[model samples]
Target: MSRGKHARRRANRNRATLEGEVAALTAQLVRERKRLDQARAGARRADTAQARLTAETAAAARVMAPVEAEATQTAAAVGPACTVLTEAARELARCDARLSRAAGRSADPARLRTALNTGVRAHLDSVHRSAPLEYHHAAFRRRRGVDTPLCRTLNVGGWIPPEIAGTDHDRIAAHMASRAGEHTRAALWCWAVPPWMGLPDGTDAPGRRTALGATTTGAPDLPDGEFGGRLRAGAVVGTPWRHRPLVALPEDAVDLAYWYRRSAWTQNWHPHTRPVPFWLGDEHAHGFPRSQPLPPGTDRRLPFPAVIVVFESGWQLPARHPDPPDTRAPTGLLYARGHGPTTPPLEQPLYRLAPGTRRDELATPLELVDRYGATVEGLIFTADPDGHPTDEFAWCLAIHHPWGLPLGRITIPASRRATHWTTAIDNTLAGVCLAHFHPTATSTGSPGADPSSANAEPHARDDADVHVLDIAATSPTTGSHRTPAHAAGRAAHLRRATWRYQPVGPGRQHRRWTWVRATIVGGRASSRSTVYRLTDT
Candidate 1:
């Protein structure tokens, strides 16, 4: 019994030892799992820190980029201004040195002031003498030998009543006064000698007025017993008034007349002055015939020529008379018809002059032929040849001359009989003549006088460059009138002929890419195409 009890005690002791070991191993496993969890959390924290740093760096970079760009731009702008200022300062210093050197030889201040004053006075006097005057009546009357009827009637004392003298003249005078007021206010008055009224020597004043009776007194005096005797015998009881004197209108009156007439007349009635019609709505068709088709394949590059056209003025006479007295002839009808009492009925007259005849002394109803001879190759006389509404004459001289060249001469007849037939000249002649006189530089040689040598070289080089480009492609992109090939050639020529460059690298090294910007002397580059090349240098 004592032996069994001892064995049980031993077994119990072994069980206790095994239980202690199991408890220690479980504690170690728990510590290891806690350390692993802590390690994972620490790794996550490290990753978050790194990502935040990256984001902050990117944000800082974004903030600094535009500032850097602005700084660069500021530097670029300041560079040119600084250069200009430097140049100006140098020029100012040079000028100061020159002034110092010239101080000893300088003119007296008083003398210089006096000379300047004298020059100013002379210039002022010249300007005053050449100034155009508002009232040029004296000039016109002197050249024309008498005051124009319109001018005479406008004068304060010119209007006369028939009761004061023996004639039914008030109606005519009133009519003339009305016409003059309606048309003469804006008329540019000037002097012109009428063909019929030969200007007397030393009588160049345009405002002079003389009584007809007094003027005729120097001629053979009428017999006092003839028409005067009949008046004295009571055949005509009242005293008679002499005929009114006539004068010529100015040459520029033709243009004024055209402007006024065209405005007053409608298109149908005055087709010649109407805006030209074009089927294609092209501006080049101006002054040309509506019926004429444009040349095929013609683009805006080629401009059409001005053509001669005609249109009509609507004017008609009364169809019937009011009474027997009206049938006898209305008082002042002669003046209205632009004829004298003794003149024949008014009719459109035509006369052809001999070829090459000088028109220096031609009268009314006269036409000069071949004034320019064979030089008048494109002589087109467009007018209302068939009495249509388009009743105007368009005479295009075949010869092309410069702006100042006199194209033709027209004479104004002084006689009242031919007053109705006044000539009208086109004002557009000024613009058209300017175009012909200034042809494209391509067709003509260098325009204007040759420039100074210093100024000429740059311009010549530029023109040469433009001439070498391929006109179509380069012209559009470069905004140049020249072709690309031409531009390239010009750039090469200029680089070889005029400018020099220095290498920026060692051992005669040239840059792989070199850009050249060209500008005209004393002028800015007109186009971006003026940049010659981005090339290997």
Candidate 2:
């Protein structure tokens, strides 16, 4: 009975100890719940901050998008706009200088005006003198004894009735040819209306109306079988208004007459009309043929002889005045078409050799003649037998001889780099023509030689190195490898020949000639060609 009572007392003490331990565990669980709640609040704040950062970054990108695009657009327009601005500034400076000079020369306003007018008239006369014969005579009114109906009517104060003038271009051209001595003058008068509005407004010092009665004279008739000084089968003819040359074809008298008649009637000064169709195009096939194609059965022929002109298509003069005198510069020729940007005409003229002509005849001595009565003698350069960039070479070689000489390399005043290289060297005539010094000789090593070595000839000594002279080099003319091996072989057989330059007159100083000798070494063949021999007159 005593043992049972002791056991009950111990069991009660143990139950009390268990109740105290349970209370401590419950307090620890509540503190853990508070910690979890604090951690969740911190996580929510971090997420909100992260989302705000992301939204700010997106907003910043959207703000910069147009700015970046605007920067890109501004960069794109800066180049050409800068060029135009530079040109305009130069022209303005030039005009200011001219005005200052004129002001200094004359204090009286009337005298200044007269001086300026006189200067302009003299300048125009000089330009007319330098123009091509066809244009020069027309502009200056070269006087002859005989007169045509157009000239007679003008001289007698009888205006050309609209009926006689005729609206059709073809009929107007026929009327101009109707009279013996008025053809060129009639054409010139027609061209004067739109471009030269001052032609009919001229009056004498007496203020009489007799100015219209004075007729511009004419020149002797063109020799039969000739259009522009006997159009050579492969020769090129140049005009004052065009930067390109017309490829002379082997046309009969009928074709020559057709060209003369049409060209005489056409007023080149008109902006819209292509004055002469010297080039071939779709219009040639369906409307008016520029030249007769060779008969089908004829043997295949090679490219016609031409002067391949090479120049930077993007090159331009810093400033150009709208006077005829401005056309005297080779750079000015680039703007001959007008102030607008120029491109190759859709129908560029092409010339090829007659099948009967010998390949060796390509180097036949020829002359580079200009309307300004300047002539330089050299061998004729043929077009690439395969095809050429007719446009590039046409402008490249069409630097009128009247502008200047030493044509190989030209450095314009105030320009940083030399802009021109007009020479008669074969396809290999690149950077060499643009070089500062004239090379005495050129040589090509072998066909398989490295092309980097190609430029070595123009810079290195001919004795120290052998650089490959591509029988055909990469140029505006033909492909790198298009020239035949036989062509190189033919160059190998060229005999050395030298010619003396004749003096202009006894009193005139004799001009020294500079020559470039080129040795082309092909497989099993080698030859020397006098590529360019320029007179420093």
Candidate 3:
């Protein structure tokens, strides 16, 4: 019994110790689990941090990519020329637009060409006053013939009459022919819209008065103008007023000038007495037939020959304007008997229309030409008047001889008239004579003239090709002259009729002879032709 009680006591002690150890182990396990959970949480946070860092790095690369690309492009696109190119592009755009607009407008080609030349004309007076080299040296050393002052300019072609041409435009050939006379005048024709050209009131117009207009030349029909003033769009091709040779005026408006001369080459002026007139919609064909094309300037067949004119004019005191020899004193007896007290003969009178003269008449003279030198002058200039906008002016031109132009003496029967022209040949004879004629519808129909043969053989003289000289057509002879094509069809016939002289020697011949060639052009081929013989040398 005593042994059994001691065993029970040992068992109880062992149980208590085991229970305490179990509690201590449980606490240790709990602490370890807590530590492990904290470590696991830290690892998860580290993974999230790594992922965020990787995302940020990728975003930063994306943000920098476009900037880098732009920087590269900028570097490639420039050094320093970029600014210049940009500015140049802007300027070019502006200039191109301006040029395009100018080209589109229906402007006179001549005026457009002379845009720069206008500066010269506008400032010619100032330039002359400075006594530049052009003024002093350009006169070909020819004296300014005070003794026999002569101012002359060649006349440009005129508009074809509406009655004959049915339009404003005439053939280049016909335009040149009509104004070939030595005394041809210069006048330009213009058209008017509903609003006619208007002139300021009270301005004097030197015109032959009509029974109706003498008192009725009153107010503008329309406030804008009487006739729509600006030249019809595309009405004419060349400058509205063909090359108007600028006149050298004095610096002071009223100052007198000394005699001046110009022996210089120039295109001749056109008649200003009456320019060719036209309505708004006239059928004026501006083309030449294929057979007879207008030749280049190099051709001798040109109607208007290149010429050097000896133009001279100026105000001068008479060589001897001695006060009429004091009629009451010394030469009274002779002066009174022969001629009544000669009121000191007036000086050579210069003629120009009063400044503000306006006209709508076709026949009245726009300019005056007397014996004293006054050749080409504009009567009135309109910068911007009613109806007409582009600069316009009336002109007076004189047709005269150029230096070295061959002189001719022609004799034709009164019934069969012909226009005559002459040009000198190289020391062979005096000159070649040309006769102009229009088509005459005859009963006997003639063959079609193959004038291509005429141009086939070109004569060479003095290292230059000698081409056919020209003669202007005369006024209508018989046929109802219509289009330029019709006129060109009836060309005058040509066959050389050389008049020979006495053969004096081998080289020199004693010949006062005449020459004639009957030229056939247009469609008019004739069976026979009348010949004219040049007489005077």
> Using lDDT as the measure, which candidate wins?
2
What are the models' TM-scores?
A: 0.17, 0.18, 0.15
Of 1 and 3, the candidate ranking higher by lDDT: 1
lDDT of model number 2: 0.29
1-537: candidate 1 lDDT, tens digit per residue: 889998988888888887888788888889888898898899899999999999868755654567779889989999999999999889777755544443336667665456545432212232244556523555657677876445211211111211333344554334223321122211111001111211222222111101000111111111212110011111110110111112211221222222222222211122232221111111111211211222233221101221221111111111111223434222221222232212211111001122232222231111111111101111111223332222222221111112112122211112112222111122112112111111112212245533323566432321101011121221112343333444553332212111123354588776221112232332233322111111111
Tens digits of lDDT, candidate 2, 41-134: 9999999999999996875575567778988998898979999999988977776666566667446787558657754221325444556766
Q: Pick the candidate with the highest TM-score.
A: 2
Task: Report the C-alpha displacement of residue 471, candidate 2, in angstroms.
Answer: 13
Candidate 1 accuracy as lDDT: 0.27
Positional deviation of residue 102's Cα in model 3 after best superposition, in angstroms: 44
Residue 90 error, candidate 2, Å:
21
Off by over 4 Å in 1: 1-168, 175-293, 296-478, 483-537
Stretches of model 3 off by over 4 angstroms after superposition: 1-357, 360-367, 371-537
